[model samples]
Target: MGSVAVPSDMPATSSAEPSSGASNSPNSPSAEGSGNAEEEPTATPPSPSDSMAPQGKVTALRLADFKTRWAGGEGWIARTDDSGKSWKSQLEHKHIVNQLFALNNLEVWATLDIGDSKQLKLLHSVDGGAKWAEIGYVPNYSFLHFVSSEEGFSGNAHTKDGGKTWSKLPQPAVIAGDAYFHDRNNGWAVTQNKDKNTLDIVRTTDGGKTWTTVLKRTTAASVTGTVIRSAGKKDAWVELIGDSGMSQTSYSLFHTMDGGKSWIPVLANNQAGSGPAPGYKTGQESKVPSNTGSSPGALYVVNPKVAFMGGQCMACDLPNTMGKTTDGGKTWINLSSKFPGYGTQLIAAADAEHLWWINTDNAEPSIIYTSTDGGEHWKVTHTFDKPQPTTE
Candidate 1:
């Protein structure tokens, strides 16, 4: 089933999306919206000497009938080039492109935040994801992307851009978390500012123009979100925080082959190198929920010796579950429970068994699921609708 393939070059970053509760510490009060349970999943399948039913290659499979006026929230595009069966829906005004980038199949890049004029609402399509054009205006920020197409970048506390023009981001990397690039003249970003309380890190190799802080430590490692790109440079992944300098309790888990200058911490809790991957639940709540790419521990580790992560059980979302590792992260498995959902924001995979996910229909109309034969099975299609009201 592997067919949608071509062009394996990538790089560029400045992605962010931190606004649910900031970090839940104003006094540690955040239920995010009141009634919870929308996404959180776990799964582990595709074994038996490795099943052969999974024929890969299927990017962005949407069937969303269409509806708006405020539904749920979270939008990501898809692509199909005579491969993965057949699918397309570039644009009609579904500006939620869940921070997307296709770079191949034709050309695509997305990001949105308008009205109060948060600025920067890019949407390009040479014709792949379909058709989209907004081109300029970028301010404020919540999440950004673009690892190709004139090269792009954006951040939360600082850093900003649009590519050939429209500026900001050219001095001591202020604060950013999860920006990626292995091409576009090399790229990398992971930050947490605050030099007074102690916790400063900065890096940028000419992409943003200038800056280098290295690592200053009040204890460092304290980012709750950002870093979930799937464009080579080795399929970037993020979600770090494992302190014990003695303030809280973290296990510290990270992975960045070479695109982030330097970072190495596969997994920890003092290390789980033995055996036991969720299957029945044993110790430390069966740990291993790393990679806070947001949207419920986001995942898409590309091919780190075979890996694919997912979560949704903040006390149960909808049975939301998915997880797998082919010896890279040491070992893991727990995928296949049907369709339990509580909170699973976004996840995308093409091979290993054609998989894609989108959850959190809290307000309703926000569900999209697809799996070809891996993860056992998953086929919802679409139900998106929340932005159709302008009778002025």
Candidate 2:
């Protein structure tokens, strides 16, 4: 089953202390000497091996493996420094970690879902998960997006001083859900106006100080937009989920070039006139019905023109289809025959050529597959085993 982008279904305990070391103190000596430190006594700025040298390489990607299904379960965050060659778990928690935002190897943020309570706990690890500090809590939030170590947005709240403090941004007429920040100042967010019962896409150019609605649902369907991925301030993709209650759930893919001012439907199923036009069927077999249970599964946008789209079967057991577009979304070449299994749960693109996908099949163990030449060839990089509890 497709995982929901909500809080986990388990309870989370604050494993680490309340950040009492000098690291968490903003007025500590480290903060004062951070940017204002003078040259050393030898008239040379500290050497590369000096004690003040930066720690660790930039973390390329982080993966959270939950011991159980979608909800509350034991999980750990694994970090890979040299692409996906080797990995090590940096943080182990007693609860399910739904999302992770890694600014670097040492600075990361995670959202822990405390099941049943419908609450969320935000944790921050500055020492590469060696120690975690409870940053904040929210009743509900979709995911966390960090543009930098100091700036991030979750739900409708923004954190400027890392995760030490947060401020609620003014909401539009609708209640905001998922959010994405491409940079420190430019971003996009999804909102739903409960009073009007409509979904809207909003943009922020000056951080979260101001916002403007660029796309709104004009149809009667209850639409929810979840940001799939973004390449920059202008190029981004969003998955629109239309819930008709008793009717079958509808999925459509939309892309925006001029920020959120305008959007074009690149691929959709069963929803007519939603965008350009419905593309080819994304099921395993041609006779399985086009776009019946398909949704935007994994999306990797290399730029405004080159992008890869993976179609997922949200409500059915049909296999997924893969496609790539070189001329933006105008024309797509189906590449489903290039892979062996269904589409992946997540897609991480190191560049236009190097990509990674996590395959979670019901009958087999979850495995990490890598494709260095786009999607032409694939190799198994890692396979997940049952997690064993580790002593902190």
Candidate 3:
């Protein structure tokens, strides 16, 4: 089946808005450095006679440069070497590109959506998008997660030969969203049991060959696992939403030290009772207004102990707040009073001390913020402009 679409106004803790089809605005942020500032080159779409096809829209960063798959495929990949000032086109394929994974500026992977009749295909490039080779095919899959070029998971299969070949593994749950691997040998997958209205989590120790259910529960409300990050085999963090009665929902954060055997509530707040998790800390209760439908904002876990959490106050006029916990979710303190926008979309951590986030709360020309000293302070890095019309 094709990927499910989530509305843009949904709470952050619920479904995530699809990033593929959004049009790039001209007023988006520009690169700081100067060189050539004009429309980037566009690649010609692959023809039936071409040897390889490309697909999917995946974006990543290597140092200062940004790389992204162009919308509707058209066989063009965009890269801005000098930050966001100027861009150049690379790679062209016949199929629509759905996702792009950059190991660096050199090695990258692209997943293609080849319509419903045929299985999805994977392509790889090692020389900075100069050329691409067909790696393998994944049946009924639309996403790609690779820890490295050689080690990664696509659909229900794991690949070790850099996508040249894939080994079909045991599937985890029926409605699995994404799989996060701490390494090639160990990882976690999150799924939702729609009938039970409960979230299910499973772990794989030997790549994706096998999985073991670690946690399953329905605590008086239907929940959806938003994001999961593992610091190691035993320590991990999860963001989830709990639906209360009468069209109300609560967002909560949990931590696990025993490989999901047990989870400790680090933070819980919403229209019901906004406060810190028990035994973690006091004074840091959430400031979101009641009846506004709050949810877990953004979570970035650098290690077992060092992490950042953003609490989103949905449909509220008040600004959102973020908290930090350096002692493994034991205690949290206010990191930022209120972000400039309505909500945060992505929280990527370069390390424990450096982090970045993009605000997506109904704002125009999205802004990217970076924090070098944890979340203590932030500065605007780039403003994403709407993509220009393609001539393919």
Which candidate ranks first by TM-score, i.e. highest? 2
lDDT of 2 by residue, 59-107 (tens): 1234222111111124555555433434545555666666666554466
Best by lDDT: 3
lDDT of each: 0.41, 0.50, 0.52
Residue 366 CA error for candidate 2 (Å)?
A: 0.8
- Judged by TM-score relative to the true structure, which candidate is superior, 1 or 3? 3
TM-score of each: 0.28, 0.64, 0.60
Query: Quick one: RMSD of model 3?
Result: 11.2
The lowest-lDDT stretch of 10 consecutive residues in candidate 3 is 1-10
Residues 1-392, candidate 3: write the lDDT tens digits. 11111111111122122222212246432222221112323335344544332222223322211222211233555554332233355666555565666555567777777775546777777786767788776554634555554666654566777777777565565644556655556667766666644566677788667878787655433454345666566666766555443333465667888887776667666444533321222454443222112556656665677777666655555335566777777676665335545534455554455555555433333445554556555545455543334459
Report the Cα RMSD per candidate: 19.0, 15.8, 11.2
Candidate number with the higher lDDT (1 or 2)? 2
